[model samples]
Target: MPARTVPQVRRWNCPPVTRENVDWAQLATIDLARARTPEGRAEQVEIARDAMHKQGFFYVVNHGFDLAENQRMIDIASVAFEEVDDEEKARYQARIKETGTYLGYKLPQYWVIANGVRDRITHYNFPRNVHDRNHPEALRPYLPEIQEMVEFTHCTILHEVQKLLSLGLELPENTLSDMHPFDDTNHSFWRFMLYDPRSEEEERKTEGVWMKGHADHMSFTALWSQPVTALQIKDHDGQWRYVKHVENAVIINCGDFTEYLTGGYYKSAVHRVIKPPADQEGYRRLNLIYFGYTSDNVVLRPLLESPVIQRTGLTKVIEGEHPTMEKWRKTRTAVYGVSELKKAADGSEYEIVNGVKVTHHH
Candidate 1:
């Protein structure tokens, strides 16, 4: 008997996004080097606060990271995703479905085919905890450099960003620091994504989108390797716009956990990626992302003492105890799975699956 051959789903052709359709605007950009002086520190804090409160997304430059290091990581990513064979890629496939462990590689189109748009993101996920000794053997070759990137981002970039966020919230400078200490068992992870170039015919079929509008479940997200302009964010006016990419800049955004901790003072931005125009679509897209998460043992609740919370009287925040990362993730996933219909602010009912809000066209 011959082995069975399964057919792959046709690549999703995302609707083409044009300048007329999307309200393109320059997102707020902050330079981390501003924190060196007292006056600059205060200005940077205010800038961070404004960015978060208004849109929950911004860009950072002069973040003290070397561009050569970034290029090196991208080189490694090219080898991992672009150069590897399918059989070799399968060696690091994550057991997210069976065990809810979010480590290792996730092949493209592994989840729902929403609106006939199958996501073509193939990624490798690395946890923030360096002591996690169970990494797949195939991923061991590139683990050291990846680990170095994770540590530098967590300790240097995210740490400083959190301090600014604390200042923005009018809380003690170190208020948000304790939640993600070096020794704490944080669930933050670094993700390296490869968006292979798609044909114009594929784009026409599904539209020019790669990812649908979604929010992350972390405290804050740090984005780099944005050599291309495909990422977009839903702004305050409910308009979709491109998050323009600038050379040597890191984009940051607040996530669900940050929103919860701030008692709704800051919001979790809804963002997605769209395929480039016909001319630019030929080049492959590589993304390096680091998301900051509260430690596993930390309780996710509103910081009641926060001046923003006090003034706003937003007492009711996240309900119940999000006891641990394992428990919270499982519980949330279960809730997103069973819920059939949910009402949005406009009273429109949409379907939910696996914690992703699905929007459909009539």
Candidate 2:
């Protein structure tokens, strides 16, 4: 028998779409380069504070990773999803149903998008400590690069954002970052997402929505720009606006955990993925994202220690017992896409777990 040759996978060259064709959101851009100096850090803090408070979403530039670095990660992720055989991917399938952890491969059609229609997205999640879990054979060769990116994202970029957010809250600079130590066992992960193209019939069935509008389950989500035009966020006026793609920039958004910790001072961003526009509808949408989470033992409650939270009288005690990070993360992950969603009066779907309500919008 002859040895089989594996075809090479090429990186996706996604060009930016014309601005006039898209409804872009005007998001605040934070320059991380300014955070190097004390004065600059102070100014950046105010900018970040306002951005978080107003929209809970923003763009970050000059965060150390260059275009080539970003492209490298994207290239490797493409290989993992494109070149790897399905049988190999199945070996590391995530047991979200059995264990509630998202550390492995998630096969397509595993999630319910709408009306029992399954989603056409497949992804592999790498933990903060890359070696803590196994990966597919296709990704094994690039583990070193993957680990480097993961560490840089957590230690440098994520920490810098945490510091700004903490100072905004009038707490010690390291207060928020300390809750998510790199060496700790947390639910944080670097995800490689591949949104497969769907046929027109499938799109009609899903109502053109790839993923429903919902808040993230973690504290923060950092998404590297990939020029896809499918992401949209709900604005203060309750209107959905498209998230614009910036070159070599990262999109940061607060999640449910951040909203809980800040006593609702920082709202969780409600966003969704829909079918791409006419110009880009034929291509697959690839995304590289890092989900930042607190240590497993951190309680899901307001930080009453913050004067801002205290002064605003938002310190009302939550009705249920505070669930630790592990419990909250696992429970949410286990029920997603599997639980029956109850329709709310406002035409949204919701499910209450542990006294907290999780809502999904169309």
Candidate 3:
């Protein structure tokens, strides 16, 4: 049988709606269906590559995944989060803040960045190919539906994104794909997020910021079109602009891993969530995100031989050998304001922010 054609997307041009001095630029959109043929694939690569260089983020459309199915999973997650008793949730609380382990559930407002209130976000993470022993019992019953979503996104969306990136980098077609082959070893995780709307009093205390600025440790992060608009990304001008959500589109952003691989040509954009608009203030927000990491066995280093890498006059300072996905996560957990007691691989414990460890107590 002939290979099926990928879905195609027409370029969309529209300015993002903005408020409060935040410039929301219209992000370029690429259609994944354009990637099935060699000629179309080349065009997609250029589009994706340009977006990476300019903003390190873009909206992907025409990806052959059911938006309704994604919403269905989110609905199920909502029930699991709201209906589940607090006692059961406590059992599955994330160990990252304490033990530096990245698994299970993280209660709301568990991360306190700066001298502000704890973030108004609760989340759960599901790793690809979960180990038998580490699986959380709380999510066992819902695993079937949840796992389907995770695998489909990985195979259909993330996989193609990586291929385009590799092509744009002027590397062998399989350079990045080879590093992240379709298998159990790929260190990807799906995050289910619930953002509680801020009340009048609580919004005043927050001073407009809901979640603090930070960068992801993975190669890239794909966020589904969410119902509310609170996410923002820092541009090259150092200004924070709302990452406007496009209908039926998935927002993709580079992370530190991509930065290291490209020798800083591709940067990891810092982003945060701010207080919702007055109309959306009382409504809860649900977001589905996938953080795709390089395969565990792939050692991260700059692809120095690529012509783009050479022409960009990029330095090799940040291009040296870097930790694999597992090590990076552990390192991130250690310093992500989890605990002053947390230590890195070198046995040094340090907290960037003092007196503001995020705890479950509200």
Candidate 4:
């Protein structure tokens, strides 16, 4: 008997974004170098704090990743998807690993808690880690161009995140550089290529591929979504407001990991993507390549950085600002994940979401 051949079927084809759709000339990005200056960086730290506190999503322009590289990764993924067989595709379905890492790719996960809803998009999910290192999930070489692009993106964002964490905690730069950039021991990343709808269906059904309003799992997420109009974020009033897409922009959002780390001045906002009222043909949303943190390690601790804020003015705000870091954390934690995490003193054994044991040693 011969081995069965896996099917290779692809039904998605959309044009690379053009001027008529998105006004890219008007889009702007925060200067990376300016953000590095002491005063400017301080303002950005505050901006980060306030952005999370005010809006769940922030539009970032001028990130260092080469625009050509970004587009190249997208093209690479699109080509790869078309080239792979069905069995190869099936390898990506979500499954648990003994090493506390999820190595498989999965479609848009349809959970029961989706407010009686499910999304209409599919994706290629992969966990991230250092290459050739001893990890629960080993990251071997796949697509060179995509790997390089993602690495550059990850390093750039990680550097910025380290700065934000330090500024939030009032720690010296040297103090943080001593520790690993992001702890891969227990920390993980879920980066994937997402496919948005082509056009809205006449009758929207529950079985198609799409994105629903849900908060990410990391404290911060750096995403490069294809220029499309489907992504949306929830307002303080809980309305799903549109997030206008811009080329060369990476949308940053707060997530559960940060909600846990910040202990609450920041926010992880709820967001989604789907068919809008105007376009009935469905579109593909390409989350070209981005990264997020895992749930096992980072702690949600309220940072009291400002010497004055910590010692004197937590209860005394100039305006309607968050009273204390703890208060902010509680608020974000509520939105990110209501379930609590219990860890052992030595930072090893801990209780997971379902009260199951998840042990990892430092």
Candidate 5:
């Protein structure tokens, strides 16, 4: 009798957490007041340091970005995604499913270096405020309204980031006083609009890995996950903890450059996406914009010299400052495309910042 009714299994399955289900302290990134003062900013940086150095991850509340702007970006993202024609959507379905991650429009299975985990999603990339206008490739041009919003978000974040850097290191205001917004390449931000549109065929794939566990290759990542439960962060216990999209708050995690800078004092957090449950089928991840930065030169090794770090074997390495603008043009493919290195199949290449896998589906 039981043989008459075996049901089908789906590709992705994840649990959701309502406000009633969360452990607020476990998810708290900082003390709210410290989030406001430079000293408080320094403490958050210390958390970034602690997270990077020991835990390899931390939640951040109020590091200094405009929450209203972030929420607006989210609104715009939904419009752009829903506007795609069926043909474009179909073309992307395969690739987005292949990487099982939302790297871009359409990607091949092996396009990403992290090939064994959740990869189902979409990404809407936005250009840097100053760099976009001057970028030779920026002429492709998005819609006027879209471009304006993106530019606004990009510049606003950059200002906040600079302030964070100054506060994190306890530097004097304008310590990077000489830095320019459009210096070309040393610092750049890219935003992606990601979502998951579950089609029935996706329910039938065998041994499917939705999105693989990986690290952001840039210095730091500021992400506003679409209030969905798929985004998970690896905790100190090696357990994947779901990062709830807190309303009006952005999540900041350490990235490659951020880690290498403190001589490993700060760590590049590892993360991945998990599929949502079947009953919740057809759920979509709205928009997640990541402000990604690249040093002008790949070799600007982070100098690890904090007093605590100096107490250890870690000393300081003053690698030359990066070249700034030319760096982006040459390294664009590596940053935006999937990893090309041999270890790609095993995800090793995906972990490398400069020498990461390079695929060209975007």
Candidate 6:
């Protein structure tokens, strides 16, 4: 482990972002302050359940942290990317291809976006327990802040949402939260991501897609709102709609693991990032997100004990023996950027991993 160094404030000018007019998707919004009471929790359960069953995406406000706190993390992330030397970053490069863990820096131009053109996205992932690993000198001083945000997101926000989901499923309040202990070994991580501006010709070659449309492999994802308007989600009608940026709100979405746990009752939202709007094309898009994974030892099976699931007669998403979180995470992470896309029977793109079929929508 590396010791913490004196915090150095690096001066890097982050480009300003502008919002443009676009058709934004109308999503369910849940207020966490109201959720603290029993009556409010009951009301939120119905709203959350409907959102999960329909689109698997929603908005959460009054989450205790305000827009200023969100911007502080983004500022630190910008400095980490802009000020860190390339030579130093190489020493901590992610071993996603070999080790199947996103625990370090991932350089830009790593993934194939379209037509053989690589992506212009760079990201750094800090695991749930930040102190257990080494980081760049630029990020060492801010490790405490990163750790605080990680714990707060997992223990405070995620647990509250999980309890509401459990109630929605007619199960005990702790049923879902128990599966994800904060101190347990899991693949959960906080990601600092940047989308570098690309030339119009390069963007055209990639069909205007920065990231392909796919569902996250984890259980839940909490994305802090930012100004750049590039994120979009595939609605239930198979239409793509822009995800509006709401200040001081965290966007919550279910993932494939959640879909499996609920017996496909809750579908995972498929989302993608495209070229920013014309007004924001010259500016870099910075993002802060936390991915919550189940404990390594937990099996990827539906909770058949839930009365809601029992009444619906839903079965497991994956048949036969279920894979543990460790196995599933490794398998999915190993093949993500390097896997060749295969055409499915319905004209959609897909990849098969561990005998399971995962779809990728264009």
TM-score of 4: 0.66
Query: Candidate 4, which ten residues in sequence have the lowest lDDT sum?
Result: 353-362
- Indicate the worst ten consecutive residues by lDDT in candidate 2: 3-12
Report every candidate's CA lDDT.
Answer: 0.70, 0.86, 0.70, 0.48, 0.47, 0.86
> By TM-score, how accurate is candidate 2?
0.95
Model 1 agreement with the true structure over 159-277: per-residue lDDT tens digits: 88888889888898888877877654777788888887665665666567676566666788899836566788888888888876577678888886777677778878888777775
- C-alpha lDDT of candidate 1 relative to the true structure: 0.70
Q: Give per-model CA RMSD.
A: 8.4, 4.3, 7.6, 10.8, 11.2, 3.1
Candidate 6 least-lDDT 10 residues: 9-18
Instruction: List, residue by residue over 1-362, the lDDT tens digit for candidate 4.
Output: 99644223233444444333421212223456578678877777666556655665665666676666566566555643455555765654544322333345544433321234443445554445434233111122244444466566666764565465456556664332233244454233445565545323412443232453566645567777565565667666655566666677777777644543444445567765545434423445556545454333323344455442354333211222223322332333232222333558864333343111322221
Q: Following a full C-alpha superposition, what root-mean-square deviation does model 4 have from the true structure?
A: 10.8
The per-residue C-alpha lDDT of model 5 at residue 246 equals 64
Candidate 4 yields a Cα-based lDDT of: 0.48
* TM-score winner, 2 or 3: 2
Model 6 off-target regions past 4 Å?
1-19
How many residue-pair clashes does candidate 1 contain? 8
Tell me the TM-score of model 3. 0.83
lDDT by residue for model 5 (70-185), tens: 55455545544555554654443423223222333442233342323234555544345433433112222333544554444445543455445544454543432224244454
TM-score of each: 0.83, 0.95, 0.83, 0.66, 0.65, 0.95
